[model samples]
Target: MNKVKLAEGVYYVGAVDWNLRDFHGYNTPGGVTYNAYLIVDEKVCLIDNVKAPFAGELIERISEIIDPAKIDYVVTNHVEPDHSGSLPVIMAKAPNAKVVLTEQGKSGIMKHYQTNYDFMIVKEGDVLALGRNKLHFLPLPMVHWPDSMATYLDGEQILFSNDAFGQHVCSSMRFDDEVDIDQVIYEAAKYYANILMPFGKLITKALGKTGQLPVRMIAPSHGVVWRKYIPQILAKYEEWSSGLTKDKVIIVYDTMWGSTDQMARRILDGVAAAGVTAKLYKMSVSTRSEIIAEILEAKAILIGSSTINNGMLPTVGGLLLYLKGLRPMNKLGAGFGAYGWGGGAQQNMEELLKAAGVAVQPGLAIKWVPDAAELDRCFQFGLEFGKSVLAANK
Candidate 1:
C-alpha cells in the first residue's frame, strides 16, 4: 500500500488484515486493520505497529515516506500483540529510535520480547515536541489493558486513539466518509459491545480528557479514521458508556429436541405483542459474539437451553461464561427451557445470569414437549417478562 497521508507531515503506515475471521474470542468476519501512523517532522515518529506478520508491510509503507532508518521515535500506544508485535522489527530498522511508551507498557514489552532497547517511559499529560507538532500522551489504564494510551498531535489537532473508537473491519477506504457510513457505524458498535463494554466507566473517564481536546480527526488503531462523523461516534460512546438502551429484548436458546425452540419463539411473539422489539437466535447456529452485540442495547434477554446430563447445554454455558466476564450493564435477564426428565437448565442459567450482574428472576421450566395448554402458559410467561421489561425501562 502507498503512503496514505493523514496530514502534510503524517501518513498511514498500517496494514489491512483481510483474512482474519476472529480476534481473541470475538468474531470479526470482515477482518480488521492494524493501523499505524508515521509522522515526518524534525523527529520522525511512528505511532503504532501492526501484527507481527505485517511488520514487513509496515516497513515498506514507511519507506515510501522516508527511509525506515530515519525514524527517531516509535510510539507504542498499546502493548497488545496486534499493535506492538512489530516493535522489534521497527526498532531493528530504526537503530536510533527510542520506544516511547507508558511504564506498564515498557514492562509488558520487556516481558514479551525480552529486548533491552532504548525505552522512553511517558505518563499522562507528558508532551514530546516533534518540531512542528507536539505529541501529548494520555494513559488510559484498563480501558482494555493497563498498557493502553492515546497520542494527540497539537498542531494537527488529531487524536491517535489506540483502541477507543475502533472498528474490526478491513476496507479499501481509509477515512470513515469514504466507506459505507452505516456499515462502519455498525461495526464500530459491535467493536464497542464486544471489546470495550466492560470498561465503560474507564472509557467515560478517558473521554473526559479527550473531550477537552481540539480534535479535527480521530485516527484510531483499527478500521478507518474518523473525521466526518466524529460527533456521531462520540455521541454513541457517551450513550453506551452511560448504559443507555432501547426497549429491545433478545431470546437466545439452543434446543436439542425442538421443545426449547418452541418456548423461545412463543416468547418472541409475546415480546412483539407487548409492543417491544425482539431478536431470536439459536446458539447452536448463531455466533456468540454477534448475539452479544445484539445484547448491548437490549433492555432484557431471555436465554434458553435444553437439559443434558443434568445441566444446561454446553453452548449456553459458554455464553453465560462469556457474559460473566464481559459484565454487560443495566440488563434484566431470565432463563427458560424444556427438559425431558429431571430439569436443571433453567436453574443453571439463572445462577450464571446473577453472576453476570443481571437482575435475574425465577426462570420458567417445562418438562417434555409442550401441549397447547403449556404453550399458552409459555406465552403468558413471555408476556409478563416483556411487560416487566417495559415497566422497568419506563
Candidate 2:
C-alpha cells in the first residue's frame, strides 16, 4: 500500500475495520477507522495507535516508511481502547518510544493494560519538539473522555483532533475530499449526535481552544482526515455544540400490532402538511443511532409506543433510556401511543423526555385502534405540534 502523507514528513498510518458493524451499542453500518499518524521529524513521533487487533497492519504501514524501533514517541490523544488497545504491541516494536498522554490518560492506560511504561505526562500548552516541527498539546478533558486531548503540529498546521471531529467510517480513501462529501458529513453528524451530543458544553470549550489554532487540516482518530471540509465541519461543530436545531421533527415509535404505527404515519402526514421537514422511524426497524442523528437537528422529538404491561415496549424504553443518557439539547419533546386498557406509554415517554431536558408539549393518547375521528385527532395533534415546533424554533 502506498503511504498516505499529510505533509512532507507526516504520514497517515491508521488501520481501517471495514467489517465492524457496531460500536459498543451504537450501530456502525459503515464500519470504523482507527486513525494514527506517523510524523518523521527529528524525533520521529507516532501520534496515535489503532485498535489492538490491527496492530500488524499499523506496524506494516509504519514499516513501509521507516523502522518502527526508530519511533521516539507514541502519543495517545485518548485512552479509549480502540485508540490505545494496540499500545503494548506498538511499544514492543519500539521498545524505547516514550508514551505521551494526559495525566488521566496515563492512569487509564495503566489500569487498562495492567502494565506500565515510560510515560510523559502533558498538559495544555505543552509542546513536543520534533525537529523543525513541534506538536502542541491542548488538554480537553471530557470533550468525550476525561483523557481526551488534541495535538497540533505547528509547521504543518494540522490538528490531530482526537475524537472531537471524528466519524466512524472505514474507507480506503483517507481524506474528506477523496470520498463523497455528503456521506462523510452524514457520518460525522451521526458521530456527533451519538458520541458528543452530551458534551456540547465541553465541545464548545474544545472548539473555542482549537479555533485559535491555524488549522489547515483536521486529522481525527476516526474516519476520513478532513482537509477540504474543515470550515464545513467546524461550522457544524459550532452549530451542534451550541445546541442549534433545524425546523424539522422526528417521530420514533415501536408498534405492538399496527395501531401506533398508523398514528405515526398520520403524524408524519400532519407534520408534512405543516410545512416542516419530518422523519419517521419504527424503533424496531431503525438503528437508534440513525434516529438519534435525525433528532440531532430536529426541533422536536415525538416518541410513540403501544402500551405494554402498562408502559412502553422494551425498544421504546431502550431508546428513551439512551436519549436520556445523551441528553440532547435545544429540543422539544412529546409522546403519542395506543393502548388497549391503560395509558402509561405516553406518560412514561414524556417523563423520560423531561428528564432528558426536552421542553415538553402536550401529547396524544388514543385507546384501542384509532377510528377515523381519532386518527384525525392524531393528525391535528401532529399539526399543532408541528406548529409548536415552528414557533419554538423561531
Candidate 3:
C-alpha cells in the first residue's frame, strides 16, 4: 500500500503481510500488517517499521511523502522483530536522525542488531518536542515484552500503542470504521487470547496507569487503526484483563476408535439441553490456537482424550501444555476419556488443568468403548457441569 494520511500531519506508511499463514505457533489465517506511522512537522518523525523483508516497501511509501534522509527522528515503541527488524536499514538511510527508545528497548535493539547506534532513551512521562506536536512516552513493561512502551501525541491525542490493541488481520482498510466491525472484533479477541492472555495482570495495570489520557485514536502496530471505537476496544481490554468470562462451555477432545467422539457428542447434547451454549472441537482436526480463542471467554472447559499405553493422546497432551503456558484465568474445567485396560488420560488432564490454575472437578473415565449406559452417564455429567457453570456465572 501507499502512504495513507491519518490526520493533517500523520500518515500510515506500513506494509501488509497478506500471505503470512502462521505466527510462531499461533495460526494467522487472516495474515497481518506491520503498521508504522510517519508524522510530518518541522521535525519529521517516524514511529516503528515493517519486518526486514518489507523494509524497502516502507521506505518507498515514505519517499512518496518526503525523502527518508530528511527524517529527523525515529522512535521504536517495541523491539519485536516484526516492528524493529528494519531499524538497521532505516537508521542507515536516515543517518542524521536520532533513534529514540526506552532503556530496555535500547538493550533489546543492541541484542538483536550488531550495529552500534546511539539512542536517546526516554521513560514514563518523558516528552519529546517535535515542533507543534509533542510525543509523550509511557513505559508499559511486560504488557507483552519488557521493552514495550506507548507513544502519545499531545496535539492529535493519538496513542501509538505497539502491540496492546493489535489484531492479526490483513486488509486494504486502514481504520476501524472502514472494515467489518464483527470481523475486527473477532480477530482482536483472538489476538488477545493467543498473544496477551498470559499477561492479563500487567495489561490491567497498564490500562490503569494510562486510563486518564485523552485518547482519540489508538494507532497500533498491527491490523486497522482505531478511531471510531476507541472506548469499545478499551472496554474489551479492561474486561478481558479482569478475568471476566461468559456463560458458555468449550468441549475439546481427541478420540480414538470413535468411542471418545461418541462421549463428546452425547455430552454436547446434554449441555444444550440444559440451556447452555457449548462448542465442540476435535483436537485432531482443530488448531490449538483457535481452541485457545474459544476458551478465552468460556466459563467452563471440558477436555477429553483416549488412553494409549496408559497415557493420553499426544495431541491432547500438547494442547494441555500450550494452554498451561497461556494460563487462561477464571475457568472451571473437567476431563473425560475412554481407556482399554488402564484409565489414566482423564486423571492426567485433570491434574494439568489444576496446575494451570483452573478450578477442576472430578473427571469421568470409562473403560473400553462406552456402552449406552456409559453414554447416558456422560450426558448427566455434562448437564451437571453446565448447571455449575450457570451457578458460577450468576
Clashing residue pairs in candidate 1, if any?
Answer: none
Query: Candidate 2: misplaced stretches above 4 Å?
Result: none
The best candidate by TM-score is 1
Per-residue accuracy of model 3 over 1-394 as CA lDDT, tens digit each: 4558998899999999999989988899999899999999989999999899999999999989999999988999999999998998898889998889989999889889976686899998899999999999988988889999999998998999989899999888899999998789888999999999999999999998778799889999999999998889999999899899998999999988989999999999888888899999999889888889889999999999999877899999999988888899999999998999888897789888988789998878888888989999999999998888999988
Please give, for residues 1-394, the per-residue lDDT of candidate 2 as tens digits: 7789899899999888999998999899899999999999889999889998999999999999999999999999999989998999999999998999999999999999998999999999899899999999999998889999999999999999989889998888998999999999999999999999999999998888998889999999999999989999999999998999999999999998899999999998898889888998998889999999999888899999999998999999999999999999989889999999788888899999999999998889999999999999988988888898889877
Preferred candidate (TM-score higher): 1 or 2: 1
TM-score of 1: 0.99
- Candidate 3 residue runs with Cα over 4 Å from true position: none
Kindly list the per-residue Cα lDDT of model 1 for residues 230-336, writing each as its tens digit: 99999999988888988999999999999999989987888888888989999989998899889999999899999999999999999999999889899999999
Superposition error at 275 for model 3 (Å) = 1.9
Q: State the lDDT at 5 in candidate 2.
A: 89
Q: Which stretches of candidate 1 lie over 4 Å from their true place?
A: none
All candidates in order of TM-score, best leading:
1, 2, 3
Q: TM-scores across all candidates? A: 0.99, 0.98, 0.98
Give all candidates' CA lDDT scores. 0.92, 0.92, 0.91
RMSD list, candidates in order: 0.8, 0.9, 1.0
